[model samples]
Target: MAGEEGKIDPMHQFEIQPIFDGGFEIAGQTINFTNSALWMILTFITLWIFMLGGMKREIIPGRWQVMVESMSNFVTNMLTSNVGEAGRKYVPYVFSLFMFILFANILGMLPIGVIGLHPFTVTSHIAITGILAVLSFSIVLIVGFWKHGLHFFSLFVPHGTPLPMVPFIAVIEFISFMIRPFSLGLRLFVAMTAGHVLLKVLGGFVINSTNAGAGYGALVGIPSFMLMVGISALELLVAVIQAYVFALLTSLYINDAENLH
Candidate 1:
């Protein structure tokens, strides 16, 4: 929570403050390193280290290798179940996407504020999530057209329908298909941001109530702190579920492209 003079600002965590005073300017656009970029880089580094450690290939696997293998199998099963044989080639892409989002979400929820470090959730921003959604959607489009050429347009039309209704149905289907990226990105962004905002608000309640007196501490602060604990657990669940949902939906969309259903 960010505030001055005892005021609370729940949305302050989402702000992307620059680490440097000024950065390189190119083509009339200024690009500077910010907290968001730092967190993203950290996410990548952490993931790399974890993966590297897990790839030691011991004759008898350790817990670290077990975890890596389990997650890899999970992603592989998700893709194969949804996209079938052709999806094997896309495993690398989908697994990377899932792990990146999962780690980013988990890193944001770490209680590092006690250590004077701020944890930034990259997925909480629509801009970041939107890019991810677009990248997945782009793969779908590219695969569809590359494999089927003009026949890919048939995706907007169902298998069998009345000739006259085909035009109207196709138009509606096209609009819905186009909305996937926005909805996909918005879902993850909203879920992550809303949970953080709620937690921040509850944190404010706990602080203010405890500061008031013994009565307020018992009545408000205690309850608020308990609720925050529960919500934090729920937020962790949401992080994992969101990552799975994202990967699952990407596979399903890829299925449509690969099989043209």
Candidate 2:
């Protein structure tokens, strides 16, 4: 293993591994704790730390307290501005999603190595992000119908349409609505997975070139190493942007459902 030709398998980093030696099976499905679950728990712990620290009213707040207050205020403002009075009720859920995703994205970028013991980014996986999207959309649907009743159907029908084209327009709207969760989840997954893969590929080039020793390989390797560093910095920005985009889009969707536009 030490003398392997190359170790550039980027997707290998996202593989799931069991924490325990054995897992229980029920109804042909295995229920076992995994690295993903561990990362999720870690995310929750990070969130708890900030929230708990923020709860302490201090004349001068610490960094963690400031972060907690700043993010809480940010999400609160986003919700109220986007979704209005009704958005206040959903602050907890929105805040939780934002912090959890923000923590997951930032932590995943840490140099934890390709080991099971290290933390991973759960948002990079489609299954996790898709589930979140579905849950949010489910709330949108339930709230839409609960608030508007039979008139909820109005969401499918445009403001003004010719009589004969109503069915076609309505069908198009329904299809667009159905595609939201998939698009939302896939957007996040693709952004994260692609960024990590690029970083790994560039890193591999640096590693392979440097391993080849002091001549031509080193010439190519040094620039590649520099490029890798640059990309890592870029990835950090992408991570924050992706997390914010997810939360912002979720708020916008809530607004669309509540206001029917």
Candidate 3:
């Protein structure tokens, strides 16, 4: 989504434009359905189709079923390793979270832009990722208090601390704990946004150079196209890794809540 009268506007892709003519007002705010929301809905539908493939549990699994099962097992293993048997109860939630993010990231990287289609990366927006991070953190808080009550605050205090250092350490840990959701969300937002911007900029180079002249195209356009291809591959890798990191960290945080470690 870079071309605008032969000029490139990389950030144009991230803009949230209303798809509907009007929106219902809540309080003083009018919330309109946007392209971002549309893409999110599309991502959900795509994910549903993908999961539906694995729904039929034949005696011998098909390739689609195996692929889905492999992703499920991957997330389940991640949860189990991070949180032990306690994590088993959380497999469904964490797996859904991981798959949604993975799909959203991959959907944004689709090359359909060449066909005049714009794909939005939901996770590129801090608001969306922040909500997800807050949700995960909320679960941790709920589980911690539900199980440990006042003892849950002890999470800020590590074991075997001397009395003098306890107060200072708890303050630092409290600050750190409070920052978790913000940091978690910012990490994903920055990664996705930065990657898309870089790709768009390089794509601009490829397009402009190719149109300028054959010599310029040979010198600049081909290299930029090649680099874009490589970065696209890395972006795909990052999409998967970020999803895993989000799920893994959520499971680890839950582990801390469940075990008070």
Candidate 4:
């Protein structure tokens, strides 16, 4: 009976109205700040503090150092297991990507309204994810070519494939490689956007039903609240998983380019 529209708009929960408007005279470019920018800035600052604070070389590990080390080790192991020892060189970029996404995801969970600001999520923006995906893809492309030269193209051709199927296989491989950026970006964007929308819709239903003095509203509201809590926890996990997956896949692609296997 609730959420009967079967479609919920999560954008309503966050205020995305533009705060500044400026047009560049030389380049003919327009720039404006929005709630999304505020959240992104917050995410960046949070990441900087957490990471920079723990960057000191300590003989005995502090809590912050241990936290940083754990995350680094996690990415290191993931890379080594998937891409071997040669992949260690990519740990810095991979770790940076993971920390950025992790911070964005966690910050979005906070109630920004408490600080008198709009609650906008970085992951909800396709453009943001697209940019990150492009960066990752670019790194993979550059590193692949740098490490293997023209041999990187050989990744499209499988060694065991028959000659007749080579052209078709190569085309498919190329297309799939090209699609990686869009696929990776869209997956994170859609998942975060959809989860937030679901929570907002459920919260709205509970509030409206309660105002109407509907006796059943309490039952529905309680469960809806619980569902929201569960989703928040799940989103935290999804955030880390998405980042790890992105880094892991990038390493794998690099490995393919290097070994041509």
Candidate 5:
């Protein structure tokens, strides 16, 4: 009867279990081997490989070096265009964030079984995204105060506003700034989670339909497979786009700190 309802346990695909057991009242935290960890490791490896491949100094750049150079140039241009020359110094921070997110998103699209026969989905985990958001926000807050000192408070109050309006505007601005981290983090987390879930549902439907009857199953399976492929490609693009957006926003925040504008 339950099967007739076409309901499947979505959480079953993502179980977070402990990696190891501790002895003698140690009670170590349960470190579930999740898809998030897999993709995180993949992201690190991807970054390592890219850095290693491009580390050599050569007058005539190899293809790998050229690729890295192009990406660096791209991020540089993005920062320069958005935040001007002074923003160049922040390029490394932005690039690191971009690469981490790009790899994370891309890694999540791969088959869950690829790494360790575990169903891992990096996007499904909110804590990871929250940490990224917190880091960016921390940078903005700390750097703003460091660069501008108490003058950073001016950000909440427009330069020419009346005294009465200043309080209202300042309060609103403070609230908005406070929410920025949560919004940015949630945006990436939600988008990836929804995309993956949609793909999973479609894939499941195809599988279930195929099991029921051959002719009908073939009709559904072909489109389902194509949809999954299309979605996967789209996810790749989204991964890069989200990374760029996050970096761009971070640069903008930093620029505001530097210029107090």
Candidate 6:
């Protein structure tokens, strides 16, 4: 049991478990809800509770109210800057995306794994991120075509390119546009997965060190613990940054589609 207790499986943390086994089915397909769904719902609810609870008419805002306002303004500024005046209409969707991702990333960093809890991060799964990316990309596509019609295709073709290079450049642009969803999703998935794995490795070392008794364990364990502390801080920064980057990139994509430059 000691040997088993010392064992660590980093990838095991990403596994998805159904919340209800005997879930409903549709057309012979088992439609079971999962931890990912649960967490996503929780993230949304958390965002709503914070925002709703914080909103009140006051001369001086409280901490939660200030945070809510700050977060709203931050995302609003990002969209307005990147996507311009037209982006105001999209503030709702973009803000929700930002909040969901930010919360999910933070949730992933919780040390529930050490306590034998079935912790999970939905953003760690490519399926979740991929769907989000695709949805964002689809919105861009639909809006672009709706506003610009066939001229939206001009997005792939450069304005001042020579005839000979036009085809090649257009092909390259097409490929890059097509890869947006893939890249966006993969970026989030990889960041969450890799960060957790590294944290788990260091965490496991900490636990294993304690099991090894004293003596040399202290020499190795102290440094690992310190490094883990640093890593945890860095991970928190990364979680916030990744969410910002995702939203920023998405805003830029929207700009590209809208103006077709």
Best candidate per lDDT, number? Answer: 1
lDDT of 1 by residue, 62-146 (tens): 9999999899999999888888989898899999999999999999999998898888999999999999999999999999999
Candidate 6 stretches with Cα past 4 Å from truth are 1-5, 57-60, 113-116
Name the weakest run of 10 consecutive residues (lDDT summed) in model 3.
1-10
Give the winner by TM-score. 1
Lowest lDDT block of 10, candidate 6: 1-10
Give per-residue CA lDDT, model 3, range 1-261, as digits (tens).
535678999998899999989898999988999988998998899999999999999879999999999999998898888888888999999998999999999998898877888889999999999999999999999999999999999999999999999999999999999998988898899999999999999988988888898899999999999999999999999998998888888888899888998
Least lDDT summed over 10 consecutive residues: which range in candidate 2?
1-10
Clashes of 3: 0
The residue-by-residue lDDT of candidate 5 on 91-158, one tens digit each, is 99888888888777777676754465654556556787788888988988898999889999999987
**Model 4 ranges with Cα > 4 A deviation:** 1-9, 20-26, 114-116
For every candidate structure, what is the RMSD over all alpha carbons to the true structure, in angstroms? 1.2, 2.3, 1.5, 3.6, 3.5, 2.2
Instruction: Compose the digit string of candidate 6's lDDT tens values, residues 1-261.
Output: 122556878777787778888888899977779888888887888778878956884669888788888888988998898888998888888888888899999977777756776667889999989999998999899999999999999999878989999889999999999999999999999998898889878777877887788754697777888999999999899899889888988888888878889
Question: How many clashes in each candidate?
Answer: 0, 0, 0, 0, 2, 0
Residue pairs in steric clash, candidate 2? Answer: none
lDDT of each: 0.93, 0.85, 0.92, 0.77, 0.77, 0.85
Please provide TM-scores, in order, for all candidate models, with all chains considered together.
0.96, 0.91, 0.95, 0.87, 0.86, 0.92
lDDT of 4 by residue, 172-208 (tens): 9999999998997888788778777776777676676
Cα deviation of 77, candidate 4, in Å: 2.2
Is candidate 3 or 4 superior in lDDT? 3
TM-score for candidate 5, residues paired by index: 0.86
Candidate 1 vs candidate 6: which has greater TM-score? Answer: 1
